[model samples]
Target: MDVKEGDVLNYDIVVVGGGPAGSTAARFAAKEGADVLVLEKRQEIGSPVRCAEGVSLSWLEELEIDNIDSSTSRTMKGAILYSPAGNKLKITERLAGDEVGVVLERDRFDKDMARLAVKEGADFMVKTSAVGLIKEDGVVKGVEARYLGKKFEVRADLVIGADGFESQVGRWAGIYDSLKPKDIMTCFQYRLTGVNMDPDFTHFYMGSSAPGGYVWAFPKDENTANVGLGLQFSRLKGEKTPKDYLDEFIENHDDYKDGEAVDMVAGAVAVTHPPEKAIAPGIILVGDASRVVDSMTGGGIVNSLKQGKIAGEFAAEAVREGKFDEEFLQKYEKRWRDELENKLWRNYMAKETAMQLDDITFDKIIDALSNIELETVTIGAILEGVKKKYPELVEEFQNMI
Candidate 1:
């Protein structure tokens, strides 16, 4: 929808992005009969995608989002983790953690999600960006946005920030802090065709190849994959970019050395724990704006979806009760925390521990896991297995156990 210049719009809730989180929030809120609007800065809903485009099927079922077959690129059976020395530990879908179930065509997936929101009566405007917050007496009232070179105001009882890593909405509302260099991961990816790899499994490579992060190959089909790597900003040396590291990795691997990149994407992702506060008066922050990415794996889709659903439900409640104060909005914060905070905190700590390991230790850990036939795969389970075979290797992770 297009708004005229100098237009002043009003809604029960205004969402500051049209990605998965924002769209999901808008859909659920609109489903509950609240007036909602989503403003997307991009001309297209999911053009120039920045995500790794992987999600766990389990969570999709939890959210009851079943109409995704057309958006799915590949259904994965598991993931294979490779140590620096090339030692491999393969985990099946049931135990492969959050990112291995399906590879999505993100552009399509995002559009489909927005379609769901539209179907539920949420209005959306592409090329519209939230440039600032509309605040009254120190409380956020809505957003100051720009669409096709025209500035406008959107007044709402509630505002949700689902803007990605470089989110300004959260900062505009004073609910976010600047991410430290160590807590940011610079990432690069290529949609490569003619790559030779297992189509059923997502593959990961660990150690200096990625430097404090890891490299991944999420297969989109039998002969194509999205190959990418992330580097912890603090670990970067002079003049070496994420693209440089990824190119080096691809050149060194036979499976990808001869492949052609049909598309490329570059971006940065927050690798920090959730913020101490994600809500201010009449405002709530979701997804990357709230730093909810999994520090261990750099995954956010599931967590973002989870948070969006909770935010939407609470926003609807706020609309019904006609209350949008910070205290009233704290219910959203409490519920998301109860459902996701503990796991996020644990993953952050695990990431810290993993970053401290040398290549030899990584090889040892992977070897231990390979030797054990675990009934389930989890950080604690992996740690326990390592403790039995290589006690000293898991010493730093004792607290997590």
Candidate 2:
């Protein structure tokens, strides 16, 4: 539906898609005094969350962003790593980053952020889907969308697209929206309600069993955890899906065979770093919408919060200064990319090399790693071991190294 002139829907910064990225962006923008509005494509804002629910508290602090709520967390003590041969090694949550992250009730957490955003004076339209951008003089000037089948247009001085992976905003803004099949990770998780877990450390199982990917059991409520699996699409070429792998995993494992099944969640994540360009003439993209997820660990909440805040702050500041071009918006890219992109670059490189290892090689590598202290087990550490022990293998990734 075309938007008529003088439409009532308008905003200083219209934020499309109110997930963590959108909410945080809206909250910060409104907190900074922008007339912000967030449109979520669902009825219940955070319901049916499609995330792994793990986030680094340490990283959270660095962003200095508030959790949408305090009531919806399942604090975990740490994480565990399992080799292809079924050998398990655990690191206290403290070890990963020292008091690092927590498993959140994602739905509640989302609503909380929405509450904060609303309290700060941001409007919300649930069941809204952004369809296209309205351009003027070759610049993004507004968004046209559908809310409960009713067409509406929102004009904004700045439009922040936090719509996550599969975002039309990026395509509308002229970004190449295609993520290489290898660049994305397909994930499947189940919120098992009657299962027994370590109750402390998250468990990650790796090797050919989950080629190009791994399996995880992240702590949630007692007797509950987000048990899931993720694998590169290439891995799925001749194998079962992540969900199927997860089922086989649980069924074969003696301790998990009888666990009652409850909620199941599934989604795809951009395991790549943020795209080369995240902002355009009159808009900026954040969170999964910009592929801000970490390729190394598949973690994104902290990164999303950080990116969203920057987009929010810049949007408001840009509005105030009347600058909305690439020159002004590029700050969003430089800030996030400079601080975090290089790490992702390294991760992407390491991931490609790591996935090629067979179970025996995985065992050898892990056994070698066992000799090194966890504190020193950086990507460089692993690469060095591969170089010293498997010189030929390192040769394959020498360019990346």
Which 10 residues in a row give candidate 2 its minimum summed lDDT? Answer: 1-10
Which parts of model 2 have CA positions greater than 4 angstroms off? Answer: 1-7, 65-72, 381-401
**TM-score for each prediction?**
0.97, 0.91
Q: Which whole-number lDDT from 0 to 100 does residue 151 have in model 2?
A: 74
**C-alpha positional error of residue 188 in candidate 2 after TM-score superposition, expressed in Å:** 1.2
Candidate maximizing lDDT = 1
Candidate 2 residue lDDT tens string, 1-401? 23344455768999989988899899888888999988888888888888888876765555455542484467667777788776666666445665456788888888877887888888998887878888888888878888766777898878898888888788888775577778778888877766777777677888865677888888776677788888887667655678788888888765556677688888888786457788888988888888878787888777788777777787888888988888988877787787778877887777767767788877766666665556544566566766766676667667664
Error in Å for residue 299 of model 2: 1.4
Shift of residue 154 alpha carbon in model 1, Å: 1.2
lDDT value, candidate 1, whole model:
0.89
Measured by TM-score, how close is model 2 to the native structure?
0.91
lDDT at residue 188 of model 1 (Cα atoms): 97
The Cα local distance difference test for each model comes to 0.89, 0.77
- lDDT digits (tens) for residues 1-401 of candidate 1: 67788899999999999999999999989999999999999999989899788777768776768758989999999989899888999898666655458999999999998998999999999999899888888877889999989999999979999998888888877786688888899999999999998989989999989998999999999999999999899998878899999999999999999999999999999999879999988888888888899999899988988898898888999999999887898899899999999999999988887887888988998999988986677788899998989998888889887
Residue 357, model 1, lDDT? 81
